[model samples]
Structure formats: C-alpha cells, structure tokens
Target: MARQGRHGATRRQPKGVAFDRWLDRVVTVAVLTAMVIGLTAVAAHWLL
Candidate 1:
C-alpha cells in the first residue's frame, strides 16, 4: 500500500473557553461596580 501526501498537523480552535473567559470578566466588573456604589451610598447616609 502507498502512503498519503501532506501529513501536516491540524490547528485547534478554543472558542468555547474564550467565550467563557469573556463572560467571567464581564460579571466580575459588574459586581465590583455595584459593591463600590453601595458602599459609597452607605457612607454618605451614615455621615449625614
């Protein structure tokens, strides 16, 4: 039997992991913003 030509390695695409990482970053930023706003409001009310 004869062998086939062009035995190159295939490239892999990690779209799922990339999307998950992006989603986590977005959620972390949103949570941090909410916490900062809540703390500022609480401090203002307590000082008044």
Candidate 2:
C-alpha cells in the first residue's frame, strides 16, 4: 500500500484543521444536548 501525504489524506483539496475541530464540537454538543433532553423527558415521565 502506498502511503499518502498529510495533505493528501484530506478530502477537501485545500483543507484546514479549524473546520474539522468546529464540526466535531458542534456534533458533540448536539449529541449531548439531545441525550440530556431525552433523559429529562424520561425522568419527568416516571416522576410526574
């Protein structure tokens, strides 16, 4: 197998790390918020 250069690995022809990090944070925050909301709903259902 041929090894690719760091830049070659990027799907975007001209790539920067800032986009990837921002995307990761956004996804993480969204998933966590969803989980919290789900748990809250379940708790309210059982407790109320």
Candidate 3:
C-alpha cells in the first residue's frame, strides 16, 4: 500500500469561484442546446 499526500490531492480554487460556477452552468446549457438541435435536425431529416 502507498500513502497519499497533499501534493497528490486535488486542490480547490480559492479565487473567482463564482465565475467558475457561472461558467459551468453556461457550458451545461450550451451542451444541452446542441444536443437538442442535433436531435431535431435528425428527426426533421427522417420525417421530411
């Protein structure tokens, strides 16, 4: 077995945390929007 230290642990950002949260939301929305658009396009192609 091996021992883990602080150097090998994940570190949290201590600055601009609010901006990071906002960016995460924006990215999630963008990804969902793209998925919807792609599915709509495929459905339209098959139906028409």
- The numbered model that scores best in lDDT is 3
C-alpha lDDT values of all predictions: 0.92, 0.89, 0.94
For residue 36, model 3's alpha carbon misses the true position, in angstroms, by 0.3
Which parts of model 2 have CA positions greater than 4 angstroms off? Answer: 1-14
Q: Report the C-alpha lDDT of model 1 over 1-48, residue by residue, as the tens digit.
A: 988876569756676988989999999999999999999999999998
By lDDT, is 1 or 3 better? 3
Instruction: Name model 3 segments beyond 4 Å from true.
Output: 1-13
Top candidate on TM-score is 3
- lDDT tens per residue, model 3, 5-48: 67846797789999999999999999999999999999999999
Per-residue lDDT of 17 in model 2 = 83
TM-score of each: 0.67, 0.67, 0.70
lDDT of 1: 0.92
Sorted by lDDT (best first), the order is 3, 1, 2
Model 2, span 1-48: residue lDDT tens: 998867755575346688988999999999999999999999999999
Clash pairs, candidate 3, are none
Query: Which regions of candidate 1 are displaced past 4 Å?
Result: 1-15
Q: RMSD, each candidate, Å?
A: 7.0, 5.7, 5.3
